[model samples]
Target: MLEILYYLQGHQSVYVGIVGAGIGALAAAIALRRARVAVTVLEAAGELLEIGAEIQMTPNVSVLLQRWDVADVIEDSLVQIEELNMRRKDGTLDGHTDIPVVEKALGRPWWLVHRAHLHEGIAVTAKRLGAAIHTNSRVVSLDHQAGGKVTFDLCRGADGLNSIVRSTLFPDVRPDAKTTNCAYRAVIPYERIRQDSIAKELIQKQTMEVWMGCNAYIITYPISAGELFNLVLSHHRPEKVYATQPDVPTEELRNEYKDFDPRIKCIVDMIHETSRWALLVTGPLKSWSSPQKNVVLMGDAAHSMVNHMAQGAATSMEDGAFLAKCIGAVVQGKLSLRKAITLYEVERMPKAFLKQQVSFLNGAIWRLAHGPKQQARDAAMAPDLEREYHVRSSNIYGDPQTVVDVYGYDVKVHAEEALEHFTNAEKDEYLGTGIVPGLEKYMGWFMKLPANQPHSKL
Candidate 1:
């Protein structure tokens, strides 16, 4: 492993063009720079601004960021949520889970953080690792061709939902994704909510609560070091909704959940400012990269899914990490860029598609109206208080193994396995062919080790 990294650093001039400065793109930049590859980040925005949104950082995401050494910056502003309480709209406690148990099992803490903090932390780390970030530099065109000798400047397409790179590759595929739901989001300062006797407990307890009900569900948690309360209310939108509308009136938002639990109703009423964001999802793309493999997609551009699983950001982070690892292999002359891109899609697309499907299903189950479906969902979610097992596995929340499968993915380990397998495959190919009669001249520089390269720390 150490030898491989030293070899990768020897080829540090492999230039990579990344099209976006979002979390996934920034992470990719950081990973590539740490591997000693030259990376440039291009952002469409003229200047980075606070997005003013909050996201959940599950154990999987937390662990990856930790491995990359940027976890401290994010951790400083995190609100550690210790439990998840699932309930029906009528305030019936359907089930609950100990977040600490899962955290202990996964070896990392789960947190809810403001998006601004996370973006800033990732940006700082990427710049520190020698990645050049250029804002207001949108990419409008890209072309690539593969031949006897593969040659093209590699470009990473993290340009987000309406990605032009994705459009260039799959022209028949539409950019506007289809969806049946939309969400209203807001953050209430603790100071404002703490004065209200009914809403004060929201600030007092460090727990994430999900209120599941007819045609809608609400999730709330403390963020910004418990300074504010973040709330997201998602509802089925039968009519076609626009991608996003920032000026939605709070009263209109509150009216959508007039029949929710009193607590939820109180939270809705307390929301003085909010915006509606469409939960659009593109089911699955036929391919995650171009035929040339020079341009590859990541994050929402690759797999945009509903947030019911809360794995949107986590999966995007994983994509960046895994893609970085593959690029590292390219840097070491162990894999061609085409092979690395193919391997990335082969391994990541399936998992991403599964998350998309499961998240859609979860949203369906959580937003059931008062009917047979709703009754069945509630009954299945009901807790078995008399069960002899000390550790609960089944409930309104997902099963324990499901939790592990979702939160326990280590991208670094998976990337290492892919590299090893690909390396072995190359050895087998070489053994089978003995030697390529005409390729020795081209392979000379690829096989030669640098004279004074040294292994670096992991």
Candidate 2:
């Protein structure tokens, strides 16, 4: 039996034990504390340092951040994306989408910021909201039995990719599968980019640019308030081993994209150091909670997906927001702990799984071979470029429906509606009867409307 290191309020009321102190964990703490739930986070690291490069915050999770009062803290650091440019391999613009117009429709702006700044802001907000955070406390084992000297109403696993909580709960589940694709990340100073005329044009636009080619693509955007430009190069590598190498040879990086546009080559030449990481994604799980319902998973621990859609962080933060909403119902005596967790899994699992598949598919679309199929994709997007109102396109960013589904979603509102449906079903004696009377009608209301529909606006 592993000893639980932290105890809250002598177990007098509902308490949550959270493992891992990443963005998901901190977001959970902030939301739960706002809901008046006691939380204690156990972090494995002795000291939390800056990790990762830039991250995109789509409206789906950005709305939650605003509600939690976190956006204000990191506002200055966030770069509001004005446009997204989709280009061919040689840097010819295939199409572009106006982010401000989309932002106006969605009621939230898509933001780009340094991952470190976002993490720090969430951490500060979590601590300020009265959540206790413990460092150097690695939880090797969790005691799930009740009536222990140290017990929790719930134990949440926000510990990412190699989640001990996920493995401990379902030991028979297979490990996450490594995709054939790998990505190299590098950051160049905006000042250096300004020296090159072609590259300088990129910074001036303040746009997120995606250059696509055969089995490969590059995404670049400004972060840290336009001081640094973040670049990510992703390509298929069937023979490469799956591991994270902090310093891959710069020559290897240049050679991989030697045939790409000269503008891209100029930027690549300036990067002296970069990291290569093998992309891995977890398969869909049957459930995100334990049989006992006291132990649950969130974020990458629940559904780790590739980053092609730039929704990994968005979806992870969305999980934290939705989970907190479900658990908050339990705190308010509106639902039992078991049912609350069930509602969470019921509402979130399918959505996360769909997003995972979409991310994989988006990669395939962006990396199509430079042939007829690629030409068709480019042709499909050409009309949207000239249209005043962008519709469905080969480029996911330009497709208004995908934008609404991915960026315009409001998790909190959806969670509340889910709770309402659950409570109504329970009252109508439809819960245990294997038939939810009003569920179909409720689901119809939940389905996303077309982009042109009035209800599509968040």
Compare the candidates by TM-score and give the number of the best one: 2
List, residue by residue over 1-458, the lDDT tens digit for candidate 2: 01111223333246766767788778878877887777778787886555789888887887877888888999889898778888887999887888898889898878888999999999899889998888888877665664666566567776677777777887776445456788998899999899998767677778898989888899999999888899999987756535687888899889889888888888988989888887777668998877888777878878888888888878888887777787677767777777777877878887888788778877877888876566666665676567544345666775776776777778887887887778888444533211112222211221233323322123
> How close to the true structure is residue 155 of candidate 1, measured as C-alpha lDDT?
57
- Candidate 1 residue 178 Cα shift, in angstroms, is 3.7
The CA lDDT at 407 in model 1 is: 71
The top-ranked prediction according to lDDT is: 2
What would the TM-score be for candidate 1 when compared with the true structure?
A: 0.85
RMSD of each: 12.9, 5.7
lDDT of prediction 2: 0.75
Model 2: colliding residue pairs: none
Instruction: Kindly list the per-residue Cα lDDT of model 1 for residues 44-66, writing each as its tens digit.
Output: 78976546589887887888778
